[model samples]
Target chain A: MRYGAEILVYLKEGVLDTQGKAVAASLTRLGYDDPSVRVGKYIRVEIEASDIDSAKETFDKMCKDLLVNAIVEDYTVKVEELR
Target chain B: MRYGAEILVYLKEGVLDTQGKAVAASLTRLGYDDPSVRVGKYIRVEIEASDIDSAKETFDKMCKDLLVNAIVEDYTVKVEELR
Candidate 1:
């Protein structure tokens, strides 16, 4: 079967996001006071897996091994059966 | 009141994603056969808005004005009430 996975990869808390900071500052300058925006990557993938469980396992492995830099980032994975 | 918005910013179809292609190639090399991956930005924000209707409008404006490059990118905004 085929499955779809959405992986959200984000910087860990306390890691300064320079890009996010710049965005926040830009918004504030435009009078959108105190906007807190953290930018990250959203990866969408379609994979062939035996079942939901195996899909989840594959997603976890993918994130850990290649998708995310665990030392500086954290990721959340959501899997669904694809038609 | 405060509202939370999750903004998914992605390259529009037909736009080539060099980074995504590199990742896909890396996965194939690792034996994760024919993995299809598309990468984009995920932005999370907490904003002060009067109501849901207004909140959605604000999110839309943010995306149009600063968050997304409309020519090559498309974005979806999801808003929720925040405690």
Candidate 2:
């Protein structure tokens, strides 16, 4: 079976996201009011695995190893069967 | 009313994502296999607006003004009423 995973990776609280800050400044300059703004990475991947559990395990490891930087980023994963 | 929008911003097809490539290389080095991978931005915003249409309009403007780089990126917006 194939599974799809949506992994959302965001800067950890207290982490300085310069890109986010720049965007926030731009928003304020443009006169759009917002409480705050933060930006992060979103990745979608399809996995060919025997079961949902294995697909999740593969994605979790991918996040740890290559996707999310644990020290500066936090990530959430949503997995669903594609077939 | 308050509405929530999930905005997904990704590089357009044929655009080079250097970050994604680096990660893909690292994954290959680590022995995890996937068909391919790409990385992009995800933003969630709470909008105080009259209705879903207004919320979508606001978010679309935000994306055009500050969020997605339309020249090199494509974005999708999903708005839902929040309470």
Best candidate, TM-score: 1
lDDT of 1 at A67: 94
Off by over 4 Å in 2: A13-17, B81-83
Q: For chain B alone, what TM-score does every candidate structure achieve against the true structure?
A: 0.96, 0.95
Per residue, candidate 1 scores C-alpha lDDT tens digits across B5-77 of: 9999999999999988999999888878688899999998889998999989988888988999999999999
Candidate with the greatest lDDT versus the true structure:
1
DockQ of 1: 0.80
| Fnat per predicted structure, each in turn | 0.77, 0.55
lDDT of 1 by residue, A7-81 (tens): 999999999998889988888887785988999999998899989999899888888879999999998998999
Q: TM-score of model 1 relative to the true fold? A: 0.93
DockQ, all models: 0.80, 0.53
Best by DockQ: 1
lDDT of 2 by residue, B1-83 (tens): 88888789999999998877777777778997753677888876665887889778888999998788999999999888987
